[model samples]
Target chain A: MNSNMKFSRKTEELVNVFQFLKKKEIEFGCTDRQKMEIDLCVEEVFMNMVRHNSTAKNKIQISVNKTADNKIIISLIDHEDHPFDITKTDDLDLEDYVEKKKSGGLGIHLIKQMMDEISFEHQRGISKITMVKNI
Target chain B: MLTIEKINDNEWKFSGRFDASQADKATKELADPSGTVTIDMAGLDYISSMGLSVLVNTYKHLNEQGFSLRLTNLNRHVRDIFKYTRLEQVFDIVDPTS
Candidate 1:
């Protein structure tokens, strides 16, 4: 099954997005661990788009699909192509980060750690991120 | 929605999903504490990076004052989050059930 939603580029809309994913998870059936991972990845990607692409004009579009082979695919499309590839971000050095007490890169770091497969593309004034996780 | 219950002046309990929207609520709830703060995470099933930032900020704030934060009863999902970020070393995490 596949589900899609459009949300405004605002942080406050996170709850709605969360509920949308949860509803789809219940409908599609996933392990608790997979659900949590997908939730975290979706949140990281959605929030990243909302915050970094604040200048974007259109709503963020997200789709969730569960495959027959037990893989969950999620994609987030932002209308404005800001061209920030989260995959290219360097791995976080925890020791140095803790020393400085900085918090900027943790969200992207978590996404990289949790998702099984992640890819990003920016073209034709659209930035899209796709992530896959197996149950 | 996220709930932060003040178990005591130095201890707090977090329940429900702790995501970006709840950051402000968490920050205000954990603003000031004189001693080492202990957070019970038995009921916290989910947490995002923004939620982590709230705790990290609180930890740093308390650290500068010669205090710190302790987290307990983190489930596998939450525990893996700390482990993956390597934040497990930075914060004191203990599980009495183990």
Candidate 2:
């Protein structure tokens, strides 16, 4: 599954791209629960990038592929280099941030809670995250 | 994705995300107003602080124009945020079923 797409900082387009992922998942004829999970996880990841792409001059590359081992692999690469991966986070300490809600972290926490196998690879000034969910 | 539907001569229900991401679209679509607008949050799933700021700014803008903005149908998640922020007392926050 070789696919590549470049996106801008536009939030609306980002939303549509997530919907496109949902459509692709449906066209693949996967299970209902799996499809919903795929759609939501994809949406959260993309939205997280959108919320940060502006500071990074709107450079985000996203790829989706279904591996031979029955796992949906989604790769998110961002030009912004800060050495942080939100995909593996498990602490949804809403208590910590609710009173003084800080931007750029909440969405990622939510995404980590939903994904299955999330890996981080930062190289050449780019952060690439690969998330695999077994359907 | 924002729209205004006339519920009555006095109240209009607003649906959609009113955040910084879509604030311009929301302001443009809600240009024409009557007396008061009751935003129905039944269809809204999530919102951010930017969205809350947009609502506060919109409330101020509408009030300046003699039209009040009242929020209704705020979901539990959003209500929690508002309650945490002590804004539930400031906003109407009508029941979702209504």
Candidate 3:
């Protein structure tokens, strides 16, 4: 199954995102745990674009598709071409994070840990983040 | 819809999805937790990064006051969120069923 959506830059659109993902759950046929992780991954990528990329003028596009080999692929596209590559983010030190009580990069860290693969592509002033999870 | 109910002066019950849109409401309800704050996560189905930040901020605030935060009745998924972030070490998580 394959589906895609375009959302405004505001965080309020998260409700719509959840609704979209909930519909995909039937087609994805993933376990409950996997569903939760997919939700997290999508939310993190979507929020990152909304929060960090303040200059983004266009709507963000998100797509979900299931591969032939039973893998779920999620893609998020930022049309504004703000290139913030999450894959290159440094590994977080849990000890230091707790000591300092910092929240930065935590979302990216979770996305990395939960998703099987995360790839970034930039071209023609568009930033696309693709994440995959094995069912 | 996220529901944050103040069960008492030190305990709050969180139910439904706690995502980015609900973070600000959670933050406002969780602000100024006086004593050892206990958050009941029994009815919480989902929590995103922004939701986690609210908990972390509350923990920091309570820790500075010579108190700490406790999370109870977390579902497996929510528990894994803490485990992945290694925040289990900082917050006292209790599983009544276990």
| Pairs of colliding residues, candidate 2 | none
How would you encode candidate 2's per-residue C-alpha lDDT over B1-98 as one tens digit per residue? Answer: 45556577556565654444566666655566666767777666555544565565556567778877788777665565556444454455677532
Q: Score the docking of each candidate (DockQ).
A: 0.76, 0.14, 0.81
| Candidate with maximal DockQ | 3
Q: Please tell me how candidate 1 rates in CAPRI terms.
A: medium
How large a fraction of the reference contact set does each model reproduce? 0.75, 0.05, 0.75
Deviating ranges (above 4 Å) for candidate 1:
none
Cα lDDT tens digits, model 1, A11-125, are 8998899889999888878779878988999999999888888987789999999889988889999976557888888888878987787867898888877788999888998
lDDT of 3 by residue, A1-135 (tens): 449899989989988998899889777788888888999899999998997787767899999999899888899999654588999989888889877878767899899899999999999989999999988
**What does chain B score (TM) in every candidate?**
0.95, 0.69, 0.94
Q: Where in model 3 is the C-alpha error above 4 Å?
A: none
By DockQ, the better pick of 1 and 2 is: 1
Best by TM-score: 3
| Candidate 2 residue spans exceeding 4 A from truth | A30-40, A50-59, A68-70, A87-92, A99-104, B4-20, B23-38, B44-98
Order of candidate numbers by TM-score, starting with the best: 3, 1, 2
- The DockQ-based order of candidates, best leading, equals 3, 1, 2
Residue-level lDDT tens digits of model 3 in B17-55: 998899899988988877999999999988887888899
